[model samples]
Target: MSEPARDDASRGYRDHPRSKPGPGSITRRLRRHRPHYLTAAAVAFALVVAGVSAGVQSGAPVDSAAAAATPSGTAAASPLTAVPASPAPAASGAGRAASPKATPPPATAAAPKAGKVPAAVAPAAAHKPAKVPAAAARKPAAVPAAAAVAAPAISPELDGQIGAIIAANSAYALGVSLIDLSDGVVHGYGVQGNFVAASTAKILAASAYYHLVETGRASLAAPMGGTTAGDQIRQMVQQSNNNSWALILSAVGYWGIAAYAASIGITYDCTVNLLTPEEMARTLELLYAGRLLSARHTAQLLSYMQNTNFETLIPPAVPPGIEVFHKYGLLYGNLHDASILVKGSRAFVFVVYTRGLSESDMGPRTRIIQKLTRTVTGALF
Candidate 1:
């Protein structure tokens, strides 16, 4: 044994440090501790398996607990939390087949605070309507009923009567207009026909002078045509005095008269002095309605008109109780009468224009006008 121990050192050689144990020694030691090593390895493997199984079981329970804690109405946590989806609608027999899985209820929103606007919510599935056909969708809606229209002012029966009257007296060129003050209805035949205005246009000059007086540009008492302005107007209107009319025309230029006529809605041509029955009626209507002059001036002018020097055409035919304020014009072939007939709470304006008449003799045309006045009064009143 002593010799063996010193053998390597004595020989000038060194043993390798990494040299393996001898085979017999290794085998014998392995044999002796083999059972213990195997037992320990088996025990370690079983412990690792048990740890993994316990981790899996515990994860399941934790997930189940979390699921149970959540409310039934709420959706599961997800990346998209703002816009919750609406519930699917129930299936109908006529529609597509029903899905196998049940539809989840919509998520409940948090209650809004006082004065705070609630968040927009998806509409309920039941409230949605079924799909309609393209044809049905494009159909137009029914139109509503229209309102009633107003009736015409001139009745057919009255119009026929006037037509008969006009036909009976077709010999002369006649234009007539009648205005019913009660309803403000105007009906006429040949109302637009033009004729020589004649002295009936004296009202225009008188109106122009009154307009100036009203605006403080002139005075009623101021002298004109060797008489006061008031007296001159009275003479021109009541007596149809050409001298007074000429004086007034000169005082108020043609432009002034035109401007005054335009102010009252009349297009007056001073050179031609042409007028229609409707124009004369409108002028009288304005005066009657107190639209032309002040109350005092209107009363004064109307007074002058009532007892005019010439009342042979309209005033003579009017009934006694009703007062007539009228103006008549007679020139070579043109003859006209414009009148305002008034009673208590009743008034009317009647105008008639005629041509092909003799200035010296107006009896036949005058009788026709009287008959027309009677016919209108009989028909209307």
Candidate 2:
């Protein structure tokens, strides 16, 4: 009807090609006629099963499974030994609380050096059993004057300013103290060498207490002795409150403050809180010149001190813009102590302390301090 359909002829040629394995056109006939082919398929399946069984029986360990089955073990560790004997609690942070008796590694073990005792340590040979007599002991060779190693702790000019500052500031006792924040120089007046802090001692307390607060070891808002009046001790001692200080002393006992001071690294002296005008100056100098811990901490502390009650001290004596954060100690002019914490383009300590006999004595005292503070502040700050 259509020339025998050319497309159908082509399809038939490809499907029934003489050498091709075409899809079954007669499946029923193939099933009945190709029984030998079905038997060959069964034999091939049996060989595959045998190969699989052989592989399973092999003892070779498989990495993934073996690792999962193994157990984990650990090496022994130990603690540190001996208390640290370093200055300033080892600023390097290398020394922390270690085992009390555990020996350290060989590389870390260090032996103490020989003592530098003076030759005079021999103690007069025990009076020589009076081998000669008491005073006749040959005067012990005059005991050779100790070789005084004059550590230049202060300069001559600074020494005079220190005295002038102390003499003028009736608030201070045992003279005054001046430290050059620009450089590590220190000078003291009055009892030039001996230290005295007085109410100014609160500065150290403030320092230690603040440090503890900053480190999270202690809380500021925490009550010292409950919410009662006794709680003032913390606020007063650390905060320089007469009433609070008395409360704290009573609660902790007389020795409590001393013990606490020692623990915190501030060597407190009962006499005037070891506030020699000189030492006060040195303390401030160390604080502002970035010589103290981290620059940030020193700056942070200087900023905090802006609230100090002391005013007539360095803050007023120096030019405007120069900040003075410090505490003022007084007793109807009988005792005047000023501990200034100053900061600005420079920093320094200027403590002018005195044991004024009369309230009027403060007139000259203020003058001396103002001049000294001005001199130092002008040069450094």
Q: Report the Cα RMSD per candidate.
A: 34.9, 29.2
Q: Write down the TM-score for model 1.
A: 0.58
Q: Rate the local accuracy (lDDT) of all candidates.
A: 0.67, 0.46
Which ranges in model 2 have alpha carbons more than 4 Å from their true place?
1-174, 193-196, 211-217, 224-240, 247-256, 263-266, 269-274, 285-304, 332-345
TM-score, each model? 0.58, 0.45
Model 1: lDDT of residue 329: 87
Model 2 lDDT-worst window of ten: 90-99
Model 1 spans > 4 angstroms off: 1-155
Scored against the true structure, residue 42 in model 2 reaches a CA lDDT of 92
| Tens-place lDDT digits, model 1, residues 45-116 | 999999889979887333444345455423335412322333222321111121232122132321111222
Report the number of clashing residue pairs per model: 0, 23
